[model samples]
Target chain A: MNLVANFGPGRPRVEQRRRRGQTPRAEILDAAGELFTTNGYANTSTRVVADAVGIRQASLYHHFAAKDDILDALLVETIAAPLELAERLRDVREPTPARLYALAWFDVRQLCAARWNLGALYLLPELRTERFAAFRLRRDELRGHYETLAAAVLAEAGGAGIVGAAALPFRLVEMVINMRSDEGSAPVFAERTIPEAALRVLGWPGDLDALRGRAQLLLAQLEPA
Target chain B: MNLVANFGPGRPRVEQRRRRGQTPRAEILDAAGELFTTNGYANTSTRVVADAVGIRQASLYHHFAAKDDILDALLVETIAAPLELAERLRDVREPTPARLYALAWFDVRQLCAARWNLGALYLLPELRTERFAAFRLRRDELRGHYETLAAAVLAEAGGAGIVGAAALPFRLVEMVINMRSDEGSAPVFAERTIPEAALRVLGWPGDLDALRGRAQLLLAQLEPA
Candidate 1:
């Protein structure tokens, strides 16, 4: 094991110094996420990301082969935690409304709290391309989880007959992206309001206060210590 | 008037032939709309738009001074009708819920029925710059209208103290943009469900069926012949 590995296969690679992340890859993603979100993804270039990261272009290529790979990594990072939570929530034996609320709450909080508005990337026309198919598939799976939870909530609320009601909870959580876009910040009321609104739209007849308590408890129990 | 006026300041400008619209400007907008919505705004150039319209780049300049101008025109067009309707609905004698419902229904229908998904452009980071301030202000005005109507609906529904309940209806209607983004079409349930959901999230306790009837009548009265 070499004590000092160069950043990449280039002449005189600079040491990774004072970037936000623990490693070169994290530093690159940090720069790319900022540039992509604020400067527009289509408009950002690898050179620019490298410049931002204080890395040479060849060094960036060493870590990620292309701009798409960097973007894919960032996109995947945004969804991975929530998707894991959603998957874990599936195995938890709780009321459907509480489960649904926890999912929306946790998802909205992340969307709101991320360092950059990476959720905004979901609107990129580039996402329609096959290059991002895996990211798209993962997003679909997450949406499926939200829909299943929503459907169960509707059934419990006697609204199973309401066609398309299941679709709104996922859409409601996603609305945080737009909300952040408009307000230039995490919407102040998002965590408190969106989860409740998601249930309300599904015709969940339970008191939101009680549902909030149960959902909070579920999230605490499931969250890693 | 000259019968054979040149399309622009250049030798042998081609006459406007069969395009989507009667005039060259409209035709240019039609083509740009398609290209911007399908390909993307940043990815498209005025030259590409000119080629799509089967015109010279100089002629395209005669119609739109810059690509930003074309986008500004499109952005303004998307909000103009709905803003007008929202303004007019303010004067109509109907319950607040019905008026709000009509505004949402009309907005959702336009978003869903447009020849292109221009609403998707609203998320463009370019809009954050000063160049698009007018369009942004108009959208804020539209949101303000929704919030005002929503607040009234809540007041009547006994949830007046519910902070931020008014914000969700506008956000809910805007979700149609995201739905279209994911699904690659106007979501089938958007026009029918979004308007109702907007009211439902606001704690509207009235029968949706009854509100729908009044809102429909209100729209019929306000719409131009």
Candidate 2:
């Protein structure tokens, strides 16, 4: 079965330091990230990860204490960056519509920028494992961020409390995570498209241009001063 | 790792026929479905499936030529049901709004009624295997069904053409597939909930009560008369 192909016999080869600037640790993370996305976290093994990175299995551990540590490093960049952005946007002066726009705008841009469908990792039931607990907490907090913003948009639109209202925009933006592999859309358009559709889903009847503009303004403030 | 824990070992046992009247074939399917949902399909083996059904491993082959066939059967009921309903809706006399509502209403209901999250199987990369080719075709056709309806909704909404329109509603209804286990929301409410949210996502500004009523009326004709 292709399921067990990762376990094939080998004394894994070591890398020759092919990349100019990246540390071996970073390279291991890159290779593991690709395999984890393609072969699945469950089906892939330490040996398979070593083989993919062109490193000896023993050398792989020198960088990561374990497989999950590599996964955690990825989460720090992939999942945590947006959480930081969401935290910053919560303090903005504009009302709910602008806050929701900013969140979806950058969030979709991040998803489009990722090298693989990271949502595949998010969907795995194996994520409930204790190894991923830290990542899970940040992920849940990001979810809470969306819910708070979505709730405001609903209320702003006079759309009153509704089941899954908070969840609607979150799922809409998450559609980016699940989009087809060959998707050729520009991230610029996706920034506007998803959050705007989200406003529609919230029954928001505000000016789209104004809301999108606020998101861009807010995005600028998020960068280093 | 808990990742592979689903593939347990067992000698197997015989069923007592706990239910009043399920045939052995039907019983095997029920057990396999439960295990597949509880455990990843790649992690589940013939022995584990047989033990779940209280049957000998050799006996499982009598009913299902192999494990994938059992999976194929579940797809027929869980995924194929919506496809069939969409086919029936195609022949009905209604606007695209009513047709999309009919599709989502029944689809969300069928999802809530199913005992397991079958969409998890649909997400597996292994689904691209040759055996699943037929299922993939039907699944793609269902996607086409959503895009056509979504395009009409977007045109009606005066919304600009952009990224991810067709995927928005499919992912929205598929949220039912990803909902948390503790969720006890009324399915009766979901019948209205998902479709209406989808119209909002499509930016449909039509009177919802009237549209929902028409969807319900068209739903009656979907029965195999």
Candidate 3:
């Protein structure tokens, strides 16, 4: 059911992905993601997205039947990779805190990767509508992933079972939405620090710096494929 | 210069501040804050706010010259209080961590206090307009207060100065924007825990439980007035 499995920055053969002009469908979705981020979902119509892509408005319908479908594709593009990481982390065996760090690290990386801070769109009130139900479902699945991992981390650390603790750390990972760091510092800072901050929040008793280095290494190891 | 200096929950006789229907202006602001939170700033016209208060739309202009004026009032009402607390915190001579905790604790209380979570309205795109510029400036001042305190805590604790550490904990304190815990548990949980979590993120070296109790007392001391 999860179409985004193995989809993300580390995907093999990243260069083979379509160039903007070479593939009209991918180009259209690219334009839509940009428009939705700038003008918002309600203000961005299919015609605007088509024009932005230098494609005819009529042809936009061939690739996506409706405007909401384009929005769905945008949401899926931004979210699916995080969901995939969560899906992997939720079922990980013992030493789950380390695995959770990997998930959080990967998630924080995605939040900062995009040229635009697309995660800000997550706060739009319109996303609550019935039309975005699929996106909502996937987002909830992501929440479940965070919550499952949080409960285990709290339990293992012998911390009080604070309801909604998962949310704070998950929000920390999602901090990239509002975060504005100097361009040079962002990648190193996020990779080096976010998991440490989250682990401290979780009362993780292990060496935080050591754990962060390991998480970085885990992601880096998967990078060279 | 700080219009919000005499703001927040600590001020004596908060109940004596206004009585319902005592003045049309107060009634109008209460209505506007509610309408803005529900229907959103852009969608809710002056007429709608007037109708909500059972006043003729033309009469609304008498109290506030423009719709954005009403929006400014609502923003001031919700935000002035926290800025006041931050203003107070920034000047405390010593035990700066303790002061920071007080500011954060009071802020968290304000976030959970209202019948509706007016803080969520801060995310609306309309708030970015030039109309709310003054409000935005004051909001940034409050952020500065938080950042100043965070820098002190990090420095005292000998933690590495990450580029945006101030923002993470600040956003952590602002977590009430999205938090929807069970109604009965909301106050006790937020009042009891958010400061501790934020301190943990800030790497505060002090005993957390003692600091939380102190923050509670500092706020409680102001309550009987």
Best by lDDT: 1
Q: Could you give the candidate ranking by lDDT, starting with the highest? A: 1, 2, 3
Extract clashing residue pairs from model 2. B13-B54
For residue B165, give model 1's deviation from the true position in Å: 1.5
Model 1 residue B168 CA deviation in Å: 0.8
Candidate 2 local lDDT, B2-110, one digit each (tens)? 1122122332333355322157677777777767766667678988887766666777787788888989987777767788878887777779989998888888888
TM-score preference between candidates 2 and 3, better one:
2
* Complex DockQ, candidate 3: 0.23
Candidate 3 structure quality by residue, lDDT tens digits, A69-119? 877777777778878767655554537677778878888777777655566
TM-score of chain A of 3: 0.80
Query: Model 1 misses residue A104 by how many Å?
Result: 0.3
DockQ of 1: 0.61
Q: Tell me how each candidate scores on DockQ against the true complex.
A: 0.61, 0.35, 0.23
Better of 2 and 3 by DockQ: 2
- Chain B TM-score (model 1 vs. true structure): 0.90
Q: For model 3, how does the per-residue alpha-carbon lDDT over B32-123 read when each residue is reduced to its tens digit?
A: 77666655566678988866666656666777889888877777766787786676555546476777788887877877876556666665
Worst 10 residues of 1 chain A by lDDT: A1-10
Report how far off residue B139 is in candidate 2 (Å): 0.4
| Residue A177, model 1: Cα distance from true site in angstroms | 0.9
Alpha carbon deviation, residue A138, candidate 3 (Å)? 1.5
Per-residue C-alpha lDDT of model 2 across residues A1-225, encoded as one tens digit per residue: 122222222333243553322666776777777777766666878888877666657777777778778777876666677788888888767788887888888778887877666665565555556877787788778888998888887877785334556676776777665553323333445667788877777777777888788778888888322
Question: Each model's TM-score, in the order given?
Answer: 0.93, 0.85, 0.80
